[model samples]
Target: MTSFEFPGQYYELMRRDFRNLAAETDFLASLLPDGGRALDLGCGTGTNLRELGARGYCGVGVDQSASFVEYARRMGGEGVEYVHERVEDFESEDRFDLVYCLFMTLNYLPRAELRRVLRKMRGLLLPGGHVVLEFGHLLNFVESYQPYTVAHHRGDGVLVTRLARQSLNPRAANWRNEETLLVREADGRVSMYDNFFDQAVLTGPEVRELLADAGLHVSAEYGGFRKEQVPPHGRGPVVIVATAEGAGAL
Candidate 1:
């Protein structure tokens, strides 16, 4: 499986179309304790950490893209740090009250490597700490498997268009995702970027089993960040919250 290296200049613009950073940060913050320490795995551009930092939460964000890390550092605020490193190689001596891997980041890791990463995340947690994971919903994949396009026009005279396609590879037991981005700058210059990767197809039960194997207990499963319960054929992402085994009182 390969990983995506997003274009740093256009990432924030692309993300604004799908994610509400402020609302997502608020939801994540609600899970943390007072002045808690948090770690973000695959934290692209460090937007969430920047938001969390303003709430007095000390945050560390790790991503593989140097451009993203550099951009994040440039937009730095108090209590947040950005590291340029792959999730597999990132290590910290200090423990955190919350460790989160969002946007289906774990799906890119090989199964065995993913298990190891989960174990590592478990080790990095303080007692009573929580680990939040987000994965694309299996039902959505199987039910609505089709190519899609996203287009954004900014007031700054930049137009962005993304063509995305994903298909199941039955033999590989995974899905191959391909995306092409076309960006037109205000100066009439156009650039194209392409990204392709294979991701594991994960369901709630599989996520539960995996977390249990890593010594984490599932405490809640939501269809979205708003704590919505998942229906049999819901179209939202699968968000799971798990706590470390034998956790102390928070």
Candidate 2:
């Protein structure tokens, strides 16, 4: 089994995948409300920040990956700023109109750690500011057994990999999943990495309860930006839109 670590070196590669999967322009347009300031947790290579900037929002991206942070700085535009730091230890006196965690990054944290991170995000948002979380629908695992391969070419080099052996433990409530990544280079060099993730797979009702426990209100829960209800069989990812209670409401 391959050991997974925070801020992996392949983050930029993963970012490219996300940019393709997520309709960044539309997603940012839908989430940015009046657009004062925004914080992107687990910002990866800052692709989302760039998308938000294009939509006229000032964006700051935070990620644990130093390589990703540096790459983002070099690609900077539209008032985008990148910070290299872990979400748990990141400190800021400034608050944001919107705080977002996307791409199932929150699932990497343990339950206690996930709660701590949520509370930290809560503290960073202005009263009534929105927090949007996007994660894979856990129920999809029931049918997700097929292996898939993805490849990309950079200059003269090619990166090819196969992902296979998907498994999940739903009873744990943390949505633990396992898979393997096999990497091959044009130079004939090969490497393999095994990835294990513990995701908090809250059903719609469970998510509502968790948000309430965190002192936030569930403004919306969508299977996708398409705004469909979560299908019983989990056809798509889940997007959660929540708002911190205004000071008066608190």
Q: Who wins the TM-score comparison?
A: 1
Clash counts for the predictions, in order = 0, 0
Compose the digit string of candidate 2's lDDT tens values, residues 71-168: 77877879789888877778789898889888777665555666667778888887668888877555655455344434442423646353544444
lDDT of 2 at 196: 60
Model 1 poorest 10 in a row by lDDT: 147-156
Q: What TM-score does candidate 1 get on C-alpha atoms? A: 0.91
lDDT of 1: 0.82
Best by lDDT: 1
How does candidate 2 score on lDDT? 0.68
Compose the digit string of candidate 1's lDDT tens values, residues 15-110: 777777776787789889999999999898888898899899999999887778888999997799988888988988989999999987887766
Q: What TM-score should be assigned to candidate 2?
A: 0.76
Off by over 4 Å in 2: 1-22, 33-35, 145-157, 164-197, 246-250
Q: Could you tell me which residue pairs clash in candidate 1?
A: none
Model 2, poorest ten-residue lDDT window?
A: 1-10
